[model samples]
Target: MYTIPKTSTTDMEVTSIRLEKELKDRLKKLANNKGYQALIRDILWTYVQQKSGDYQPQLSNSDIRASLPATAQQEERCVLTGKVIRPSEGMLLGLTNNGDMVPLSIDSLED
Candidate 1:
């Protein structure tokens, strides 16, 4: 036997933003092809989560340290903190604080 948890639902105020002509045209097309309101709702949800700094992917420490292809690793810095990123890509391997070398992905940093 399994039990399910109950959750509470809350009401939210909806606000609209004025999009530029080009963007609005594209959005209108997308909404017509798909459900516009649903598309907008998903976009808004992601935007709000990112703005609130509450967005986190469920990943473990070992998951974060997975190997990258010989390519992809690159030096990156924390945008908010500006700390130097160790080399994870390139011919040279990055030395971790624990003295372990890890491959870094330059492309992943852009994301």
Candidate 2:
């Protein structure tokens, strides 16, 4: 007789997300034996994989530099914070939800 192997999910990091009560109920109804957590995790993993496959960071250094706004090129006020950053000061460029690249101060960003 062969025994089934147990799968381990212990190595995965746990995180919480807020969802609407109605949506939660709907997910629970559809989850059946898999449970809501597993269903949500599978959905998120699929989404991440799909999005990752679509992403291509092929921009050259000169292309990136040319894409920046005049203010960012001059290293003036930060796009997100509006705080003045000198040209010599260290700054980070981040992509916004609108797909536009914006300059930000390193201090304003979270790890």
Q: Candidate 1: lDDT of 3?
A: 15
lDDT of 1 by residue, 7-97 (tens): 2324545677777889877777867865665566656665564446553322223433333345334554322223334555343234444
lDDT of 1 at 19: 77
Best by lDDT: 2
TM-score of each: 0.34, 0.41
Candidate 1, 50: how far from true, in Å?
1.9
Residue-level lDDT tens digits of model 2 in 59-106: 323333323223334644444444666776767776655465756666
- Score candidate 2 by lDDT: 0.56
Backbone clashes (count) for model 1: 8
Q: In candidate 1, what residue range of length 10 has the lowest lDDT sum?
A: 1-10
lDDT of each: 0.45, 0.56
Clash statistics: count for each candidate: 8, 0
* CA RMSD of all predictions: 12.0, 14.0
- Top-scoring candidate (TM-score): 2
